[model samples]
Target chain A: MDSCQPDEKLDLAGVPCPQNSARTLIKLEGMDSGAMLEVIIDDGEPVKNVPPSVEEEGHRVVEKVRTGDRWKILIRRREE
Target chain B: MGIYLDNAATTRVDPAVASEVERVRRSAEGNASSIHQHGVNAAKHIEKARNIIAGSINAEAEEIVFTSGGTESNNTVLKGVVSLSSNEKKHIVISAIEHPSIIETARWLEEAGISVTYVSVDRDGFVSASDVEKALTAETVLVSIMHANNETGTIEPIKDIGRACTERGVLFHADACQSYTKIPLDVKEQNVDFITLNAHKIHGPKGVGALYVRKGVKIAPLLHGGEQEATLRSGTYNTEGIAGFGKAVEIAHTDDVKKMTELRDWFSKELSENIEGVLLNGPDTQRLSNIINLRIRSVDGNRLAAELDRRAISVGRGSSCSSSKSTPSHVLLALGMDSKEAEESIRISLNKWTRKKELGIVVKNMIEIVTELRMV
Candidate 1:
């Protein structure tokens, strides 16, 4: 995990579900294929909902780390 | 025919407005943005609609920017005004009982570091100008109050609040979706900077509304596109819908207000006089001509509305926006009612075409229904 550097990072700590996930997807959509993106989202709904939505869109969940009230999610954009 | 008592939720599109929509759709074949003859013809419909809406509100034609509906108009003013304000002018004031569009947008703004002050309304759902004045600070850049409460029908003191805001040098916005055609709104006389009007509420096409931004007020655009709406709201013009909206406005006469008021009062009187536990939620006076909100003792509003639906009589439990959720009405709660009382509240709105006989049938059904519901 330490060896992989993220191409993009997003802090959606205070943003609610759907919007948080939506912002993450929008950010991921702009990234180059195979590039990793880091996202910080609020716990509970955001944490539980965003990862599945991203994965369903064919992105790989590289890592998910819980950091206090938020979770840090690392995603790898799918190569189209 | 099934009765529709939920005009506050939305009204049936007027036949004239529907004809105008179809006419525009069939005749205007090009986008309003094009420079050709087709485009010119399409732009004519848009401009004519713009003039009609502007004239209806006593605003200049250049002041109206069309959008999808009331929600978008509300969003544009709240988001647009705040986004462009100086850092020192980061606060906005709104009534507590505002529509979800304003409330939700304000919440989103709060998340984005902007400060918000929600002025509470009275028991009758009227927001006092003084209370709004008390909430305003040097940092306050805008005050958004609805012209009438959609649930309770109580009209706010918009002119007083507008005057106060003018004196304070703060922008005032009124969501007049429910009151635009029913009430007389003169922008200059009211001293309001922005007023939101929608089509569906006034028997026009859905997905079309306009924001009346008083000339010289600068706000950021919510959507960035073809630089339409004088670069304030950019999108391809919705010509058919706007034309329908114009027709709706043109046909909405002041005489209809008298007819609606009479029917509303008659309905209220019949329900309250006949039903033992019927309670009028908002002020009997200064209310919107179309809306009548009530709370029946020991009754569940959701259950009542469902039963009405079952009988093909459509009514609303709360603001249709949030009624799907079981949460008690924020408007009712702000009006000092407990959750149970709020849960017991129902909103029945009449339109210009709402007949006397239909309401009589509704009253008869409600009287029987309330009695049956109370027993259980």
Candidate 2:
């Protein structure tokens, strides 16, 4: 759960759906293959929409944990 | 107490309306179509409700045909009108910014070999009546325009468009789902053949609404069962929901309209002054008073909505109709706003229950959040 590097954090802590996916996409584009991204979001539609959208974009969602109303999602950038 | 700024999506049922609904439900009311004593009572209640809803919109009770909700009402009008018309009169005109129900229904009509012209809106989201005039051909059967936009609160010039349709001998239908209870609507004044409104927008129970069909106008029915609602709409009437809807309309007509409008305007002025880069979406003078659409530059509306929700202030991003879709608002795009600007748009709608203190908190929290997010 703590595998992500401190400088590699992508905090989407208070963002909504689609935007979370969008920001995750932008961050993934700038990162090297196999780099990890830590995403924090509210648990609702995003919990359902984000992982699939990320996977479809060729990234791997490694861990998804629900802590109260917030969700911590980890995505690993895939090799092209 | 969580602030509810999503009134455009749906409103909490008023206590009075809820009580009326409960009373009807607890009675185990017989079917309005049945001939029993309980059925007679239920039928009487439904008739009273029909009258109340009709009087609120300045239409006859017979013109009000109850439906499940706005989507069904819109579908009924668009499909019903086209189905009733001859193949020669296959042309239909609709605004580009109409609700998905209308736009999608028009799309279906297009697929069915009907000619459809989508009239564009101005920068402020107002559809020009002259554009409708220019689009009308002798083969045009109907013109469907919304009375007020759900996202931007822009009120169209329905009366002028109605007059044009009248002169051209074309049927006119206006979707008044968002504006019916908040604004004054008169079928005669607008001269529209059909008007659609939903109960849930006005603090009434969900699952119930009415479509106003002008007397003597012929249209095909969307559903067939028990020959209910003059055979235009057919289903076992939702007695309790209709009762709540009637009570809500009565309350709206007598009490909430003036108070909510005042609260809406006050909230808009305060929010605009407090938040920098806030641009109003629709016309200042012509929009509905209960809705305020503002674009906060550089702050993603989805993020802003999440932050505001975290602070217990519940506003919405884009129209509730398009909330699940990932794209920016089509209505804003039609109004000539760039995609980025559309993504920054948030809709705040007020109701009678919205208080000044709550709005103050909302404005304060929104200003702080947007400021902080912009810096990031």
Fnat per candidate: 0.00, 0.00
Regions of model 1 farther than 4 Å from truth: A1-80
RMSD of 1: 18.1
Instruction: Assess the local accuracy of residue B49 in candidate 1 as a C-alpha lDDT between 0 and 100.
Output: 81
Candidate 2 residue-wise lDDT, A10-74, digit = tens: 66655544445655665677788888888887788778877887887788888898999888888
**What would the per-residue lDDT of candidate 1 be over residues B1-376, giving only the tens digit for each residue?**
6999899999999988899999999999888766444665676678778778898888977788999999999999999999888866499999999999999999999998899999998899989899999998989999999999899989999999999999999999999999988989999899899999999999999999999999889999999988887788889889899889999999999899999999999988898899888899999899999988899999999999999998999999988998889899999999999999999999999888889999888888988788889888
Query: Number of the top candidate by TM-score?
Result: 1
Assess candidate 2 and give its TM-score to the true structure: 0.80
Listed per prediction, chain B TM-scores read 0.98, 0.97
After TM-score superposition, the amount by which residue B53's alpha carbon in candidate 1 deviates from its true location, in angstroms, is 1.0
Q: Is the docking of candidate 1 incorrect, acceptable, medium or high quality?
A: incorrect
List the global CA lDDT of all models.
0.88, 0.85
